[model samples]
Target chain A: DAGVTQSPTHLIKTRGQQVTLRCSPKSGHDTVSWYQQALGQGPQFIFQYYEEEERQRGNFPDRFSGHQFPNYSSELNVNALLLGDSALYLCASSLNGGVYGYTFGSGTRLTVV
Target chain B: GQQVMQIPQYQHVQEGEDFTTYCNSSTTLSNIQWYKQRPGGHPVFLIQLVKSGEVKKQKRLTFQFGEAKKNSSLHITATQTTDVGTYFCAGPYLSSNTGKLIFGQGTTLQVKP
Candidate 1:
């Protein structure tokens, strides 16, 4: 299996601009989760998608939103980005309703200038 | 919201030395998972512990879940260049159905030959 796949390995955006990151879940997986990792820090949970609906959210503001498609692929959309928003965005996928380990993508590096 | 805290944000050790990172959660967890991220790489799943007071090993790495399920740990028997990375412990939120993970801040290990 290809495991999780993310698009746009790196992105550079201006403050106040918006960015969208994409992720394709691993084969046979049905759940997708997004996380943000600042330099020298562990990933912070952003949200999780299952059955094309957001089932859980973190402490992040509503400016961070996401969507999961029918094929279990996912997208993370950040609106009105700030310099502090710059970080590595990670995507992880796991099987729903089962005890399964998560598969993570290489992640997209977002730099807000 | 739950919180996972890790200690000693960074560690520098000589090759062949042992190292350990600890993780504690604000609330009891049903399961705990560990991940390792090489510099400039995404987090990769290391192992998972589902039962309280359970321990598992992988080569030189040992993982343990607390008796109360409120904490966990990762121990490396011998340091190596390959073991130089950030280690993270994560657990699912108490009320999450989508299996969203709350990750600790992580402990970065630097191995010197």
Candidate 2:
């Protein structure tokens, strides 16, 4: 079976512009979470979506938002992008609340120039 | 805010040598999960430790959870080139909530043949 998949492996955006990243969860999975990882750093949780509703979010501001489709796919949208927003955006999927290990996608590398 | 810190941000070892990375949490955690990310690749699930003082082994890799649930460790015996990657530890901010995660900065390991 195919694992978690993300679209647009790489992207570039200018300041003040917006970007949308997409993810398809692994088969039989329901919950999807997003993370941001800067170069040489670990992934930081952005938010999680379940049942087509956002369940929990990290310390990120309103500029970062996401949505989950009925099919368990997800989209992470970053508005008013800044230089600091340049990073690898990861998408992970789990069966439930993620108590078990999470399956991650290769991630979308966003370059804010 | 909760945070996960990892030690020895980078490590280089010879083939057949051993290596270890420690992860600590500023707040108590309900469970800890480990993942490995190869160069230019996405993070892959390694293991998860839920109970206090829990220990789990995967071939040459051993994972441990502290008695207080505030610390964890990943030990690799006889390291190989395939082991060269960034290892991350993550846990939820709330013990009962598994939707969000606090990830360690990650330990980057390099193995020389």
Candidate 3:
């Protein structure tokens, strides 16, 4: 079985521009969550998507948004990116509410220039 | 806002030395999970603890959850070079069923062989 997969392992974006990162959850999983990991810090929750709707969100601002497709794939969009937006974006997936067995993707490294 | 804090942001140990990392949460948690991330790699699920005062062992690694469900710890016996990585403890926010996790700052372990 395939684990969570993320696209564009590494990306470079300029200030004021926007970037979209994609993720495909592991097979037999329906819930997807996004996290941002800055240098020398733990991953911070961004939001979670279940059944094509956002179920929970963290303290992030409106500049960060996400979408979940019917197939359980997800996309994280960051608008008006700043240099501080540079970080590793992680995608995790699990069954149901992830009471157990959560899988994480290698993550997309976003470099805001 | 719920927060998870970890101690000893970094640790360096001899190849055979033991290591441990502590995690504390500002609020009670229904369950807690652990993950390990190697250099230049994504975080991988290690284990999860649910019941208060629960303990689980995985080979040389032992995991414990506090009696109040607000703290947890990971202990590694006889560490090796392969154990060099950052260990994170995470738990869901109160009243959240969407699998959004609040992660600790993480303890980076460096084992010298």
Query: Each model's RMSD to truth, in Å?
Result: 1.6, 1.2, 1.2
Instruction: For each candidate, give the interface RMSD after superposing the true interface residues on Cα.
Output: 2.0, 1.0, 1.3
TM-score of each: 0.94, 0.97, 0.97
Q: What tens-digit string does per-residue lDDT give for candidate 1 at A1-113?
A: 33889999999999999999999988999999899999988888898899999988888999999999999999999999999999999999999732466889999999999
Error of 3 at A22 (Å): 0.5
Positional deviation of residue B38's Cα in model 2 after best superposition, in angstroms: 0.6
Q: Scored by CA lDDT, what does every candidate get?
A: 0.89, 0.93, 0.92
Best by DockQ: 2
Off by over 4 Å in 2: none
Worst ten in a row by lDDT for model 2 chain A: A1-10
Cα RMSD of predicted structure 3 = 1.2
Model 1 TM-score on a 0 to 1 scale: 0.94
**Predicted candidate 1 versus true structure: per-residue lDDT over B3-102, tens digit per residue:** 9999879999999999999999999988888999889888888898998899999999999999999989899998889999999988887824346788
Interface RMSD of 2: 1.0
Q: For model 3 chain A, where is the 10-residue window of minimal lDDT?
A: A1-10
Docking class of 3: medium
